[model samples]
Target chain A: MSNATNLDGAITLITGAGRGIGFGIAEVLSERGSVIAISDLDADAAGTASDAINSTGGQAAAFQGDTTSQDSMDALAAAVLQEFGHIDILVCNAGVIGAPGYQDRTEHTEADWDATFGVNVKGLVHTTNSVTPHMCERNTGRVVNIASQAGRKPRGARIALGSVQSPYTVSKAAVIQWTHLLAVELAPHNITVNAVCPGVLWTPMWETIAENQKANNPELSELTSREIFDLSINERMPMGREQTPRDIGKAVAFLASDDASEITGQALNVNGGAVMN
Target chain B: MPESSLGQLAGKVALVTGGARGIGLGIATVLVERGATVALCDLAQTACDKAVSDLGAAGHSVLGTVADVTSRDSMESAVANVNTTLGGIDILVANAGVWASEGYENRPEYNDADWDITHSVNVRGVVNATEAVIPYMKEHKRGKIVNIASHGGRKPRGTATGRTLGMPYSVSKAGVIQWTHLLAVELAPFNINVNAVCPGELWTSMIEGIFTNRQNLVGGGSGGSVRNEYDEFMQTTVPLGRGQTPRDIGKAVAFLASDDAAEITGQALNVNGGARMN
Candidate 1:
């Protein structure tokens, strides 16, 4: 599809851009003429993804930043502003599914809740706090948070995934609510904050989810991991298809664009295209 | 400045009932921007003509039809007009609505006529519009239907008087959501997905009336006093600290009509600046 909106010389900082949906967002924005600041916890992975973009004739610089640390994000934000001079967009895409042993928990522990929120929720605060002051100073910025469909809707009862992934889901719900509060606070600064809730996508995250589901669910024990993923997609997604990382990228790109400036504190679900029309 | 790239409804036809003004017109505007040939269905011929010509002057493919959602025959004729003039309808936004502001009190003890008018226009109108479009949509084997509901439908709003929102209007809107869910299931086989867009706060006549009534119930300066009250309400209750615009609701309805929301149906999506997240 031909893109009518162009970012041109926009500068965007995307957390967790080393792989998966974050990398997908980086690629799309870069295609639209954005100079990317790719920050990830894994330094080598970040460098590899940045190289991939630069090799494709896009401008991207990789930086290592641990989202779990406020000081790390603060330092990373300063380094990025120093490197790029101005930041136009920030994608809070770094997320953790659960606490370390959450997948095995029958009942979630307090540590599980704390660990999950520390990364998924507080990580966003660190990044936005470090960067939004500059945005307020300049009076221009966009913040696109990557939430999930699970945040907006409850998973069906009796689903093993629901119990195992409660922390991730709750944190995403927090992300959406936070998006609203920040949008309200930052609107005076001309900064629009929004969240994109993605549907089922084939990613490393899904790989783990599918593996666990196939092992845990009696109905899917015999099937391959891919089949299990496809089954979930068929059941959940009305279009009976899986979303690509680029599908999410398109949504993030739009939310970060100038045309959507009026849209703030909203969550746009990037699922199987609604085809409602 | 670059134009919006959110045009997923290109080459389609959209009909927005009650499209003469307010939220309906707002929805028509976005659909036209998305490259859809639009037809406005309204109760007033003059308003409809004015809306049509205004949009036409801006280089949009648009027309107007006179229809009353309370009258099935009137709606069917409007849908037929769209079919004959625009070829087919791929999208329908059932947006005609009325608040319980006529000859009634604002409290729970609102009079009988208000109840009749509320259900007649808000509830029956949505059903009429939806029923009129379904057959045509079924023939095409695909359609998107969006009903314009309100945040009042999901929860009971408050006034400084400690009185609740207009009960009849709120109840009718809730009924609209119920119908949307039911229609989604009934129409899914025909490739028709139905959803309700529950708008939060907007500065329309409907909202103006609400403010006027609130002032009547509890004095907020003059009966016309609303600016300060609106700001206070937004800052206090809404997380986004702002009222939604008609265009904001329009964008949401357009998205629901587009391929991006194909997975959504039988759902009441809130577009109220996070006023109500669930």
Candidate 2:
């Protein structure tokens, strides 16, 4: 109700902003008058998101950066700094849930585990490490990590036909822990670090999961993938409603705003009454 | 005090346990500032009355009630009195809590009374206050519950005075945090959002007393007062380079109590200036 989170004239860099929660965050923050830099692994998607914001009279630019590559992050930070002067906010929203692994951890391939951690855990580190020095030098910054509810609670075969193995959950848990460590480390520099745990957003990631579930089980072939996803949401989400990308984005905006100056080192759950931790 | 920028809590009735002083009073102040009528419940009538008079002089709608949070009967009675005077409670800030002074080195000698008192006020106190407000909130089908916990519950950290305050205080806070989670799950059906705010080392009388005890325990041979030791500890331990104020904790409580946090439940939000992150 209180739209006092004034981001006027601030420069915000959001990773994975081509779509989903990251794009939602970029849109809302831009509406608050912040200059946005939309970075994603997909160059065309980033360009389109940036173009859409720019067409709406909001200042925005697109950059292609892979979170898994430290060099790419550094380059992205340097380019953004060169263009916008300084970055006041960084939202680490890039993450990956590996292909459904074997039911047991022992049967899971090393590549599967590495890929999950590579994008979720190590990618977050690369982006934070690249941008924090500039923020520390300026003595002000805000970092919002988009973690998931699975990070706080074990998914444990909750999806009707879908299976979530250890790699994704463990990586998200690591992101939460890393958010804590970075929050403490950056506090002295006046940079606030926090994590947002979103629950059951109908993003491309979930669509992929739903498609995989429909394909993996022939018993559920009659039901569409979207129907299966809805069933999972109805069963797990206590609010009896699906969470939107904007819901998570609003939460990220609140944490990054000046109104939340006292809030740091906290992982706020933006779920629909699921995984209350 | 600064004017409340957002009247998000206007027309809401708030009841705060241990509202005589410290964090509870701070939370009550914020709620009242946000245009909510507040009821101050504390162990003693004198302290509650004094606090009410002080806050009343500021042109706020506030009442004082004598209630021991450790006793369910007293809490229930206090809630009844508040409902009769201020209307049904829309928000409950369970801030009543206590700490143990025994050192970890002397854990063997620590009596059962120490542990009992700590758990009674910190853990059971939250339960008593929450239970009293549930029926009123259930009738309305809407409410917000903010439990005051400590950073000690989230993770291990040195005391403000750089002394070990033992495990009872941390363990009790952990119980409070866990209780918040379980209550959030159970009460979700009633549309009551239950959350906890874990304050870091705030400069309160309770913490000042701990600092003094630590100074005395070290025999004051370091040639520094308790305040100085606390300042140094804050400088080194707290990444923010300062201890939190009561208002800091109060603002967090106000946030969770507002409709802005409707979707947030079963959360342990740390307001310790990055002392401990969970």
Candidate 3:
């Protein structure tokens, strides 16, 4: 598809950009002429991703930052601002789906809840707090949060991944609500905040989920992990297809561009007919 | 406005149905503010002209035309006129809708007239507007359509304290949402994005009328005003602790109409202050 966003000369910061949806967003933004700053917990993976982009004639820099830590995000922000001179967009893509034990609320641990919220909710706050000041100083910026369709509706037994009672689902719900709250608060700075809700992406997160489901459910012992994943996607997704990281990247890139200036405080669902609302 | 600061709808032509007042006028105002030439279509020529004059007084490029949304011929004629005068209809805000006053008490025998009026204006009206504009949009291979729906459509039918949006209105709005989804898929190949905006508890004239009717129905000897009832409902229901304004709805519509929402389709965006998350 032709790129409609004019992100040329823009500086973008993406958390968890080492792989999955974050890396996809970084690659798309780089192709659109953005100087990408890849911040991930894995320093080596972040560096490799940044090098790959730079080798493709794109401007990119890698920085290691733990999204769950405010101080780490602050340092990452300073490094990115110093290198790029100004930050134009911030994509909050770092998130965590708690362990298999966290799927059932009755059996879930407090630690599981904390881990999920720390990365999904608090991490969002840290990154937004760190970079929004610079955006407010310049009176312009874009914040695209990668939320999940699970936030919109509870996933019952229809999906084999995250349960409706899981902390991951609760955390994503918080992310969507936070998108609304922050959009209202930051609209005056001309900084648009929006969330992209992706449906059933076959990422490393899904691989772990499939493994856990197969291990726990005895009826699914005959099925391979890939087959189990495909079965879930086919049953749950109305479009009968799984979403790609690039699909999410395209949605984020559009929201980050100047074309979406009037769009703030909205959650755009990139799910393939999974959750209409 | 500076060239850079101009809205994304600059140089675009838009047609908003039922634009004489309420949410329709709000959508039209925002479109005009964003530099689009807007045509306000309503059933009454006098009201349409007054709305146009009101917007024109603010130095906006606006026009008023008479077209009954329930009548396909009227809508086609109105759209044809807008295409002739405004160059072409690049954006369509199908805001023409009507609310039935019948409550759940009359659910069994809800007058045929009441139900027909609600569906005719809300459901068929949206279809008429979309059908009228689709040809122009398909020929151009570019368009944006925003349908004004309500939170009542998303929620189940039940009257709790302050929640009394009539069952017919709720059903009609639900149809609007479903229609928006189906049309979005069909129109995507044409590059036209179709979406619905569901507003919650806005203090519009229509809603004020509903509150007054409710007060008359249940007020009895109580000395409470309808405004007080509305305030009470907002406090108990809305998480944001307040109701949304027409401007909030307008801004959301403007965003969906803009190129910023180019990839967004088959979606119903709720701008109801977190009252309905889904």
Candidate 4:
């Protein structure tokens, strides 16, 4: 078996565990034997993830909490603590890409920025802040934040050319910086904080963006929309290709595990060579 | 293009340097399954022949060649052979590399010969292979280069010996990053993508080399081989509590080589299992 396999019996909590990268992480972690706590904005979505895990004979529980709300974060953390006793791992994976057409700093409204920051940045902060105290008490813990490559390099074309926009990019950048900051602070507590920056992945979010572009940009056909989405990264890395949610999940699992103890305060790139750090 | 979308890389040609074993071999295995004709080149002729034959037995359009990535002439010949046989070169995985450093206290003094050899294979080797194939890509106006680096290159020297004890390996890897960046910008006009894949520690010949080096340095004692301590050290540090496998890196390399990553350019993808966030 691979060293990364068989993650059984570890108690782990994941924010935004309902779907996408967060859900993917939950799935892999469970497969590797981590007892999971799935937290999401939608209770039903979180239940679905927990149910999927249960169906596979894995131990999991679902918690519904508004990612942008402190009360929600606290309640979820409390529930996990009550049921699981202690959380060995925390994944602040909840995030948003913001509303479409919210391009350029000038066009971006304060409300839009606030909403994006609330979900992407503040949501992460709330989740981490809630779990870290317990973790610090234990003197051993792992926090994996889901960031975006947009945080590192501001490739305007990545947003302007496709579905993502300023709020998502800005919020992700904040998450990355915050990760570094937290890493430094938490390292002394023996708690490692790191972010997983993903490149483009074919997900429901991507489909929604593609559909919106097709419907909104009436001048372009559906086929053109697909091509436009395909042309995003400029394909600079000749050997391999784009980031996948599972790819990010695997990296997160690795980080959350004991194998990465010496690795503190580092931003790991899981973008399939799309963004090299 | 996620979740092993069937035939994503159908009808493509790929060349993986140092593809005889380890992460490179894993990448070649995946690409072949995805319907790409794979060409694996290694400095060791016996290893290359064995890999090619074994992969060929698996019903893949796979070929093996003996070539040193450190030498431009060797790389050129290998690329030329692949081009003639495979019809054209579309994907280049500059994955051939050697780890010469074990850290400071492990070796005490830096070995210049080890450092030079490491750079030749890791840095100059990647440059040589990419440079030799770029003209073909320029002719076709499209290509991809994935340079394999390490997560060790990303962090500071943790232990005295810096894990493997050689400064050149880390320095060369740093060079790999810049080289990837430079190539990415220059090849943009040619529609060629150049990126680096910084893999975390995996169980490969490279790691084995580190183990052997550590064992020799420490000699026979109650501690036994240095690999054990190194493995324990990795276990404690990696968030995931595990080391990466070759296939883990292979799947990532496969994604970067596929059309799904068309928009990605001049970037480094860390497959280190949360060891590095950026």
TM (chain A), candidate 1: 0.94
Interface C-alpha RMSD, model 4: 8.2
Against the true structure, what is model 1's DockQ?
Answer: 0.23
- Per-residue C-alpha lDDT of model 1 across residues A1-277, encoded as one tens digit per residue: 2233358899999999999989998998888789999999999989999999999989999999988898999999999989999999999999877666543554556776887698789999999989999999998899999988777656345445446777777888899889877887887677888888887888888876777676667787799888988877766656566777777876677678654655677776766432211
DockQ, in order, for the candidates? 0.23, 0.32, 0.13, 0.13
Task: Name the candidate that leads on DockQ.
Answer: 2
Off by over 4 Å in 1: A1-9, A28-35, A51-59, A99-115, A152-156, A161-163, A180-190, A257-263, A271-277, B1-8, B104-109, B156-161, B181-193, B222-242, B260-269, B273-278
TM-score of chain A of each: 0.94, 0.93, 0.94, 0.89
Better of 3 and 4 by lDDT: 3
Residue range with the least summed lDDT across 10 consecutive positions in model 4 chain A: A233-242
A69, model 3: CA deviation in Å? 5.6
Better of 1 and 2 by DockQ: 2
Lowest-scoring 10 consecutive residues by lDDT in candidate 4 chain B?
A: B1-10
Residues B1-278 of candidate 3: C-alpha lDDT, one tens digit per residue: 21123455787898998888888888888778877788989998888888988888887768899999999999999999998988899889998887773453323334666678889999999999999999989998889999998877887634455444476788899999999888877886677888898888878777776667676666722457778788777667665456777666776777778765555677987776556645
How high is each candidate's TM-score?
0.85, 0.86, 0.67, 0.63
Q: Model 1, A197: alpha-carbon shift in Å? A: 2.9
Would candidate 4 be rated incorrect, acceptable, medium or high by CAPRI criteria?
A: incorrect
Model 4 has a DockQ score of 0.13
Predicted candidate 4 versus true structure: per-residue lDDT over B42-155, tens digit per residue:
888888888888887877768899998878998999999999998999999999888764453356446877788788888889989998999999999888888887765665
